[model samples]
Target chain A: MSQNRWAQQTLWGWGRYPRVESLVARPERRKEVLDALADRQGDPVLAFGLGRCYGDAALLREGRVVLTRRLDRMLAFDPETGWLRCEAGVSLEEILHTFVPRGFFPPVVPGTQFVTVGGAIACDIHGKNHHVDGSFADHIRRVELLVADGRVVTCGPDEEPELFWATVGGMGLTGLILSCELQLARIDNPYIEMESIRVENLEQFFEVSAESGHFTHTVSWLDCVTTGKATGRGIFMRGRHAPAGTTGGLSLLSRLGRAAPALINFPVDGPDWMLNQATIKAFNEVYFRKHPKGQVNSIVHYEPFFFPLDAVRNWNRMYGNRGFLQYQFVVPPDPSHKAIRLVLEEITRSGLGSFLAVIKEFGERQHGGISFPAPGPMIALDFGIAGQPLFDLLDRLDRIVLDAGGRIYLGKDSRVPRHVFEQMFPELPKWKAVRDAWDPGHVFQSELGRRLGLSGGQR
Target chain B: MSVLILGATSRIAHELAHRYAENGQSVFVAARDADEAARVAADVGVRTEGTCASGRFDATDFAGHAAFLDSVRETVGPIEVAILAFGDMGDQHASEGDFEAARHVIDVNYTAAVSICELLAASMTERAAGSIVGIASVAGDRGRQSNYIYGSAKGAFALYLQGLRNRLFKSGVHVMTVKLGFVDTRMTYGLKTGIPIAAPDAVSRAIFDAQRGRSDVFYYPHFWRGIMSVVKAIPEAAFKRLSL
Candidate 1:
């Protein structure tokens, strides 16, 4: 175990921000996982899976990062119960590919299916259906956690409540999540009964969203580029799984026979100056006009409806090497929707419009100490980094969010200040208590954990 | 239809087994590690809900190869498809110093593979059916000083596959030799290279398609053919001088 060689490499979050130099180990089996952990000595080690975290949650600076991607294997599953026990490194994309056509689907999937089950658990990712079915971790039955003491602890909601909740959104600081038992949802078919509604202004966007609460999945693409009367106009889309024996759009005989268009990729990172405010505004205008004023109903494959961005592989490369920030923050529901309006107004005043803006409502909040979703509307926008000016804009937006009693989603933020993070997650100490109990020496730590003061004993 | 995957615990073989099982074929997983093979079998079984079984079979054990194949035949009936996906890339540096180490690498990659393939070929010739695909390596296309021993062994196996394909052609048995590129598996886990590494599942898909189409030889990534062609075309003097 001590003889295992750890290679030095550079790693960054999905946003490509704050690239960290670390000693990396990619283990293909459980024994090798132990080898990597045993050879860690006193340095912190974090299990990195697929690295879908938009921030630094999966990175460890100058520490060992055990790459879990190679450890992917389906261990066990019960067809009748629909309980799948798989290694933590298995990506949701693989699961969907293998299971969806077979009539089973993950209960919840984030915007992109590239994320690993462990990453989904670490961040407690919420999806469009989050307003109804809750976050991804809600479907997890149990987890096999490799704690700092070289012991595998099986924890669940009922088995070890404290450890379970703490590790749920603990940001890999608790320990390395080795494997998990996830409950796969039984679906009628692979098709979705979808509707696209063109929204006009922020007030109407809220109204339409509240009205469409009955739908299983709902999300809106807000055009932040627009100002004046069309301040927050965008397209509001909602969908539910297509019911049995009913073809909403596809002919009954030709079900699932639709040919998929060739996948387009960025190939390489585009120039940083490509996505200026003018170009974004123009694209947004054309996108908005394409959808009709009223609702348009159709039956669509789950692929396009759930993971549109996934179709374009290496879509993140479009942001270039300098990197970009996906500033995502959630504001608790205010009937007036003041926080959202204020944030949009600030962006408009600053003469900046994000490249991509998404708005989704989070339903019931599950009580995890650092879980981001909490029965509110969370808006995420991609902002090209312009150094201090971009940081200043985000800082101002943070204050507005704080005043509105909202918090930024740490999972998507690469540059949120420590003070702001502490304020946002006041229950950090409670989570730390459980973490300290399991990892007393802070063996399981990452760049995100270090930067946010998530653990004790800084030295 | 029944499919037998040797070295079932390997990512590529596991996926090939999965592909066959999901298509409603009886799948038998065989590997050096019995417990690991059974575990892989059970995982595929759940996904496909097909007849799946596992047994212990080591590729290096020349004497025990017949008995292992018999056990699989007894359990899963006639194997319509058989994939040889096992190979050991022993430390090239050590192999250079030790003849025993070099022999072991050759034995596992070439000798063991032939030992199994010949037995399967004999039975398939009698039945006048089956597709046998051996996952060889692009490393075999041209030997480099860094890994010449392993490359030469794989080079031998690919040639063996080509000759076997010709012999089996008269018996209506399709034979495929896959010259795999840098795949994301245990073999290429941490080795640094600029070439794009192919995923195990993607490689499995290509092999599966190749067998079904009765293609004799094809590169997993397809582009590897072009790369390997250039390598083979290089003058031996120049190739040795430029040590890759």
Candidate 2:
């Protein structure tokens, strides 16, 4: 390996290796990133956010990888409309910490807080409240995209709408998300008025989540190892931000001003062998016990309610060396919801029961043709790489997803088959048409783009 | 057979899991996060069965080491092979006045591995059929200013692994020591640019080769062996003058 390219050998995701050349840049401003893009005439360029998206979504092979963490800056926030504007490199944690105390919260937030807004927009991340609020893209009012050309272009629903939609879930293939204007939600308090319900199987989970959807936000944690009669057994969590006077009467200002402990390392990178069934089960049991069955508890903090896993620094290292894969997919609302059961069954039969299995209801039609979400039940599970079986099992899952008119989240995928992608995403040609319009040279690309034939020699 | 990888969640450990699972070997990954371990196991095609749980583990939880091993044994059954891949190198200068930093480096490297190996080595000795691999660094051979604090811990581990190998030589249990130079991992991400670094895949392959060949000690990159030998032979008085 060349001396300069050594760092590219591993990324934040499952140990997917990408061979990059000597050129690497950390652009503190959008101009630098765009200038670097212009400097390389033919070589593909990828904008690296917090490097949180699992897999090669941000990796550009033999090309330049632009680190955008330092480009963080908050431009504006309208309290009345809950509209906040900021640079792409600003993380969700920054937003929450800054605005949540000011009576505002991000419309959608993934499980982790380390991800950059650019990454969030690229992934169009959905959270437990996806059934209500949709994705990160849903809240985005406008985006300043640093296109293939050196010029910066503003895109939104009305202006360059196609580019805006494609760039939302485009996985950084279309262009770099330089800055974003997002519509946040007004919150009364920092803590969620949380409630937990135990679901016996897949049927109950769907029933509870649907019923809980009538309220606001809902999510479920399925026991993946539960087999036979108790298959898909787990807990369902439902919540809304507590009213200002409900609990300790904590104000939004107090919560926003509080700073989290300085990040030691990304929790996702914790050593591999840190957790096991007994310990996880115990932790899960405690977590469950903390919120008794149907007990309405008024929690008063954002950290535990939103990012509980963040408490332990470097938690991902717990997975040991094998690393982990996040398999997140959404199925359309079907007649029987058999697709969800089948996917769970497949995971069970494969004997790869993830420790954290999250099931949520997706409320919006997937934006960007090939993006992973639709109007159905979304299931996300964490899997550690045991070898080829994971690939084979995922292929089977892709087949199941495709057959059911479902799609895998490209942001979280590393081994999705090209055929499966082609079958699932019919909008590739249209997006390609728009992308080609912006720059026929195909300057912005990523490993995910290359792997699935979204960009490169074959395409 | 389920292989309980102690440090198996490292880059090399992850690669070993992938290679073994490709050949149909069952893997049990134990790490700090059960979710992450399960994820890795699934990704590598290994079933997260039995004691393949990821939760809080202090490799240097000396008093609890036996209990930890027993817990793993009870959950995952007999570990056919256990590879220790859990050492990290912190900044040497920063560790000078900080006892917590020094202790953390030691705990993660020598103390943690030794604690787990005590139980593993005992079982392997009894079974007379197992292999234990440790990824020690060539920096452990001779200390330097660059990373001597982390290097000292590895030095202790390397010596311990050598002793374990000598003890297990006739017991039919194999213990291999890997004198790794620098593998590009998160630990070395802060290193100055242009440093010679080995890729995770290359280091992983060397690990797999060493495990299969049943070698006691193998220098990764093989070239590191010659380079380290010459470096070690240099007079310390002169070596101290030049910044490493």
Candidate 3:
């Protein structure tokens, strides 16, 4: 390693808000990462992987951030069983590009494929198929973690389950994940038979989701600007892996098509008033009216079906230079649906509508102690960072979500109070106990962990 | 078909290794640091379908250069392209007062480079094929008061490359010297150069293009050629009087 390897850099999450300056060390090897951690630098350190989270979950602020991008490498792969072991820095896109043509795919993939495996595990990210396969942690077989004492330990569901569960969704505060073994799912082809249904309201969305339970993937786009009878009206999409021999010659074309880089990119942030209520309402109206009333069935590549937003690089720049905040929360699966209705009503009444609100149903919760997904209906909305009013509105929405037995996704959150966080995740104490046992000195710390009082005695 | 990159762990060299691998060329990466070399090898291997391997190599260890080349040849076959990218820009102020420091800089930048180049030149000459790319710096064009110690070493290395180029011209061997200006790399991390800095990606692309073209003493980014020409044209009396 060079004598002067650390460089001060400004970093932010994909949301692009709440930027912070940090001393970053890009270690190219496992030994370098270990040496940096053991050097007794006194500054709290966090392992950063691609910085795909929408908030400070991956940011350390004034602390040290060990960038793991250079450590990306495939350690081992079992072609027979489709089990792969790779460094934590390997990205989902890399994995897909290598294995998709070979008839295998990651079981759980979030909206974007640019995230690293470590970041996906840290967030325990859920995807369109969460209602069937659960979150990313469900497919993880084992993980090697570099703890505070510089000891590398192998943990899994049956081995060191406490530490494993805590580290899964621990926001990378427990330790730096060195590597992980994942169970990849075999697929016939890369194409998906997709069905899009235009729903009239929130109730119709629930009905459509329930009807599409047999489908491998399901998600709904919500028009948050619609009021009264048409509130939450939008398009519902369900997809299944295209049957064997259906794609034929098109499979190769699909693979090559997805490999092409995105052509449309938002080079700069739009004006502050670009995503205002008036503009969002107009967009939502046009989007809702654009889709046909009946169900539309089509065969498309999995990339477009699963990661549509990725087709337009830097899509978040549409929110403008001030950046935006992604407020995603999940409410318990209640028959009354009162909680979700109240939240949507509050958003519409605030006169601030997000053109990118998405609603999905989550299945049974995984084993991760702090995992975000549960048996619930979740909603994710993006709002421009317009100051106090936005915070106040989010606070009010948080109360309704809390009353309905819901918690916000930490990966997408930027501003939830400590008390609210504590209330939402009652298992925090258990996660803390496991973390303290692994890292007593609080060596592995981040701004999100600090903000939520998850750093134990150090905070 | 095969490329050998000495000092493969350096930011620019590492990127260049990946570029070659992605282009379907086999890569053999060697560096003084075994762990870093292995990491680069693994990264390049995973990113491309081409064969990749790595070995430990110390530029200052003259005796090890021949053995390193032999090992690479045995592992990945005769290297079609060999890149010399190892050098240190020592602390100029400290080198001015410390003879040992100055000697170390000279040895790394010039002496060690000469030893490796000689061994590589002999092996490639015997094969009657292959290209050698030396990553020299534009600082060698004209010495300045700020960093003459490092600049003088680069100057010597560039002159040596020019001589090697002339010797290898008739042997079917290509010798290309990459004269780089201000590059945004770890070596120039925080130093404000006042010049428009080129990214390592651009520099690596230029190096690849130079190797393919078999160009001798080409300036990276193309514009550096004009800039260095103007600097070299300045009279010594006038150049020494002004702070550059």
Candidate 4:
């Protein structure tokens, strides 16, 4: 039976590239979600969270996109155990707003809190605390997946382990995650005691990063545009959850009332030149110089420490109507952090400086399906779209990463060549095998999936 | 205080249930679909620091109103806030062709609404403390050929709410009528409107705030009040010729 539930609309990833006009259904309840999936009209169906994935990993051209945002609902929460059972559409912001006052937070959150809980698992997202806390999938106790045959299978570490691991970084290809049981981490207070240390050059960055490993969270903001005497200068910031009785902090109750901080919007799309090389370099210079020459200690709210950019609503518009591409890649730990240094040198030499460059270290590697974080140093940069030249630059960087035994984050990739992806992720066959077993029909698909040959029919 | 939301399947009503639940009030979500109601109740229950419950509630079942309400009061406490959010915009064209269709629209939007509300009014008047919010529509301001059937039903409901407010005034029971413009909901699913549609959550917040201020009636997206006033002032001769 045909249903008029699908509305024809245009969808784009957070990068705002490769926009697709697709038939989309925003389901407000579980039954509506099933109904939307069942009446696909012979088109492939993929469930979409908040469309926060920077690339086309969540987009599909002319296909059925089931929007899960409206399905948000918290089924249950055990405050004593820090266990939260919620529908997949619940955003991390909502979770933080509701739980932070109770002295609990998600085990790991990416740079933004706008992403849905399901999106975090789909990407196996990590935060500055990856050195200690790992990624989102590690804290998941169980997930209720709507598989190809339309059965809701309860999978986890013990039960359906293969399916559980596969779904962790499965990019929504394994199945539609309807809801899950997440293990939230307890906090003494809803604040972070942060310290920023100025580091000059790539050598200092790795040294400071290593020394700060014992800290709960650590990351660096790099001046990737600088060359010669000042190359790779940055400020390494580390923080831990503020201990109880920390002076000059609001009581937990007031902080909870102000959990959602007010935001100022980026009113209009900036001109292309707004983020051009010269402007970025100038901004980087001032940013790098603003921090004190020595270490400085401060106390901050979790919102600013973890999700700094989220403070400015629609900040992505600063990259203009075409938007910017966020390129993030990881290289395995090597002698003297050689791989990362070489990559940064190439980035600076290109003269197409990234607007925001951040570096973080991942702890001991964890085994799993296509999860991005491992034992390595990861760097993320945002560059304005400059057409073929930009793609060429990425292609050059791809070879360097491939040679260094590293890989580009699929979540941040919108234009990686198929061959490069194949070489970067040799474990694709294993992930595909699990997909075939669960979704032999290849009913679930995405634009990124088809672009990089991550589907059953492609090869 | 505990709140009861009838016809809670609608997005606005769900948001209303959510707001009350978050405020630490016991919420009862009742709808025509038992499973759907139970699911929403489970969802809303997590937000409340108190308690939440749900039961099957078909507004058209006038015969069962009292028993259903009594069971609800038993599950939750006395209903301090009652909102009637159920209505049918039965296709105007189809409604005109069949009396059953027309009656269905009128029965749910007008008759059934008054039935349960009177039951609520009776108890609220006795308790001498409560608030009732009736979700009417701005379409009720002036009837047009396109949707006069649904419009007229809503018009009667709004008029009924005004009278109810007067009767309950001496008893200190507050009554509020909300004339909503186009809300981002399933009801206005695919329609294109000149003005940006008000979000369901925003509309819910406005109604909640209005009820707190003891507003007898107000238009959602407040600008709708101005637009409706002009439409209401249009002469019947010219209004009849224009399709709305």
TM-score to true structure, per model: 0.88, 0.62, 0.92, 0.94
RMSD of each: 3.8, 20.8, 3.2, 2.9
Cα lDDT of model 3 by residue, A148-211, tens digit:
9988999998889888899888889889999999989998888899899999999999999888
Interface RMSD of each: 2.2, 15.9, 3.0, 1.6
- Could you give the CAPRI-style class of model 1? acceptable
Chain B alone vs. reference chain B, TM-score for every model: 0.97, 0.89, 0.96, 0.97
For each candidate, report its DockQ versus the true two-chain complex: 0.39, 0.01, 0.29, 0.53
lDDT of 4 by residue, A265-338 (tens): 57788998899888888998889889879799988788778887776777888888887788898888886777
2 versus 4: better DockQ goes to:
4
Give the TM-score of chain A in candidate 3: 0.96
* Cand. 3 Cα-lDDT: 0.86
User: Comparing candidate 1 with candidate 2, which one achieves the higher DockQ?
Assistant: 1
Write the residue-wise lDDT of candidate 1 on B51-115 in tens digits.
Answer: 78999988889999999889889999998999998888888999999999999999999999999
Candidates in order have lDDT scores of 0.85, 0.73, 0.86, 0.86
The 10-residue segment with the lowest total lDDT in model 1 chain B:
B42-51
- Model 2 residue runs over 4 Å out of place are A1-10, A14-22, A248-296, B1-244
Q: Runs in model 1 with CA error above 4 Å? A: A1-8, A41-43, A225-230, A248-263, A289-294, A455-459, B98-100, B114-132, B138-144, B155-181, B194-196, B209-242
